[model samples]
Target: MKKILAVLAVGMISSMAHAATVGSQSYKDNIEVGGSMWIPFGPHADSAGLPGVGVKGVALGQLSKISMRSVRKLTEQNPDYGATDGNNVTVVTPPAHGKVAMGNFNFAQLADSNAEVYYGEWTAHNDTAGATRSVYYVGKDKTANMPTSGTATYAVKGINQYSGNNQLNGTFTADFGKNTLKGSLANNALNVGVDAKINTAAASFNGSATAAGKTGTSQGHFFGNNAGSLAGFAKFDDRKLDTAFGGVKK
Candidate 1:
């Protein structure tokens, strides 16, 4: 009787494992797409205490929205083990007729189990003041992970106002399972023809982040000749997870 009982226990365990696998697959199959939206506050306030003039606070005078989306496919091994083959990112700011709008398109390929390579292009249009302007950017990002941690390198070029600026490069590295991301950008040249050497600079940010449930902060510095000497600090808190779903109507 003891031997028969052991055999029955083994069968029950196998049945439970199969049930769990099926449930997990179903969850992955139903996950269509997801993204996030961040609303900036006091850090964006103007020195005059008037809001929205600078990057310190939200510009209620204007409407801006940013979003990201991914198209992922499930793998046979594990429904979640599949890949994200494409992504679309968009930023829209209103006062539509005279405002600026931007969009970025990204295509990604899973080169291996833990590595992905992506190519993206960005375009921005502004019809503000008496000036009508546009800019275009193209870039690539390569990310990889192995025995230890992971790293990514991104490089992009911008063409604006009929002038060419060759470089905006960034590098990021992270330890396995850590919420912290350490990264830096260098030799960034902005506003090429107008400022020439004025916007040439180097900047770095090293911060720890606790996501969704924990508060976190990071501080960094930037130095450049064109922007005429500026420095500041940044922080994050009250992080939470939220969801939204919508689709275009026929």
Candidate 2:
């Protein structure tokens, strides 16, 4: 009997590799939340490759619930990436822009977090597209710190626009456990003609994102007086999980 069917196919490949190594070690010991995030608003071009001035629209949302709690752990990778290590991520917007709210809080440790590293702060408020209100404050200190292996390097500041205009400043850095994320932006006179026509700019942007899918790409550049100076780029070609209690969730 063909050696007992090759020992039942090697015991079903050793029980599927012990159930994927016990589901990646129980996704690194619990604190596993779900995911869904999408950000797209029209008339674009504040920087990073310009080009979107045709007034379109698309700003969908759904993060229904995102919770994670796994404190203390200096090693043993994969706990849902340490429940997004030093977690704090909020995005609730759905009422056609007027229901805008954004947040990012880590307070400390997130280059990759090997311990003794800090830099994190981001807050944003909004009222989508036909803008009526907007606000943003950002931070990421710890210029450079290293305790013999627990690396660090960060610098960022912020002030956003749309509430009387003219206010946009940004900076970036990363290197904790190195899943990498970068940034850059500068603006001070973007009064798009109401007879004020002011436009001064400086831009450099980078992108790399991951959770399961929907890759990344972003680029920008735009110069003053609008006589022509623009560049743009964007790519995140795949992501789908629609559920208003219907079907689709994968």
Candidate 3:
């Protein structure tokens, strides 16, 4: 019993040491192919590995705090680095357009990795047409000290590749007791519903999504000090668009 307690105490200390907090925004990018969106940055964003080929380097930025507001007359930008991925609750920040918006998404990745993963939605005001909408993050996965029971609700944001890379926002609920997640995203245009089962041991999840008569598969991982955030990708059956989303514990 003493040995077991010692091991458990060590594990707890390690997790608290790597707890999530505000850190530098290292890099952010997204991709569109044949009208579908995909993440171009991640823990291996700078690796020579295939599939995404990784990025040369990350564009650093500082996170700010603001409030939630709807973006007006915005178009999706193919590639821009002038936005912050902010959750629509708690902390908020104003975008380049001078509009107030929620913006607090900083978390720690798994200790074995040097990458960070941030998830939230943002609009870039660097475009002439107006601005571009996107979902982004800057860390990897860290799911230590996660709650073993109870439920957590999150405010989610993402990019819809089919809708010209438009912004998608909604809420997601994670049930730690049942190890499940359910979420929905919609605007004045369309709605998307997602469901997934959580693997508590792996700190990951996979499931299905439905939207406008189309079905898709969704997969993502949990992050933060106590599994306070999540981010993932969804690919539809029609191959029309891809959705990437993330959120913070609300």
Candidate 4:
């Protein structure tokens, strides 16, 4: 019993090290494939990573604090969905959009023979009025982490945009497997090399893939923690965008 408690304590500490996210956003429809309309959490324009952080980190705490508002179920003829549960529900994982998972995803590939991996998901968030949406810290749990080292090729959808202040919202498209991302791994971090070939201007941010304001020639650095997830910041060319991302392994 004592040993079990000790292990649980260690796990909790490790989870804290990897940016913390404590809230759930459920979805009656999957936001990855554009099945349902987007939902708003916390503020209309929130960051992407941890609360009060420089990067466009998600304000999970703030999101959890927002007052619930009633939403009309489009599927139903005329039923008030009542008020939402704020950010305190099991999240619905986003679907895969082309090569990229519409939801926020993170991986940690160890420098070993077999790649050990874990991941999680959160339903995408959106604000129609602001035309903004997001998905970060999917699963929002830290126990599930993956390992990715060396040259690792995966898919990532669209791009993130961060104003001088904070992130607008999490966003992606419905073209499953449309974009692929490549990253090089170190002992504790993965350096996602920017593909200059990708037309940043053509790529999307919080909504349309063809949207503008896309920059070029940039990289993302994701650091791992004992909790089995990764959180990192990103910057684009011409300083057009900056973002902090967190996700679980697949």
Clashing pairs in 1: 43-56, 44-56, 44-57, 45-56, 198-226
Q: Candidate 2 on 1-250: residue-level lDDT in tens?
A: 7975564344334323321110000011111112111112222102111110010121212211111111112111323222332122212222333322322122222222221111122222332231222111111111122222222223322222212232223333332244232443334532110001111222122343221233434332221121111112222232111000000001
lDDT of 3 by residue, 1-250 (tens): 7975564344334323433321211123421101011212332112111111111121221211111111110111211212322322212223555332222121112222222443433333233231233333334335767688999998877655323345677999999999899989876666878899998877777899887878877777777668877777565644334456667778
Candidate 1 structure quality by residue, lDDT tens digits, 64-152: 11112121211222233222322222222223433222211122221222211112222223332212121211111111112123322
Which sections of candidate 4 miss by over 4 Å?
1-14, 17-60, 63-126, 131-150, 157-193, 196-213, 216-250
Per-residue alpha-carbon lDDT of candidate 4 for residues 68-140, written as tens digits (9 for 90 to 100): 1111111122223112122212222222432112222211112212212211122223322322232222222
Q: What are the C-alpha RMSDs, in order, of all predicted structures?
A: 21.1, 22.4, 14.3, 16.4
Off by over 4 Å in 2: 1-202, 220-234, 239-250
Q: Any runs in candidate 1 off by more than 4 Å, and if so which?
A: 1-163, 188-250
Candidates' lDDT values, in order? 0.21, 0.21, 0.47, 0.25
Q: In angstroms, how far off is 65's CA in candidate 3?
A: 29
Q: State TM-scores per candidate.
A: 0.22, 0.17, 0.50, 0.24
Better of 2 and 4 by TM-score: 4
Judging by TM-score against the true structure, name the best candidate: 3
Which scores higher on lDDT, 3 or 4? Answer: 3
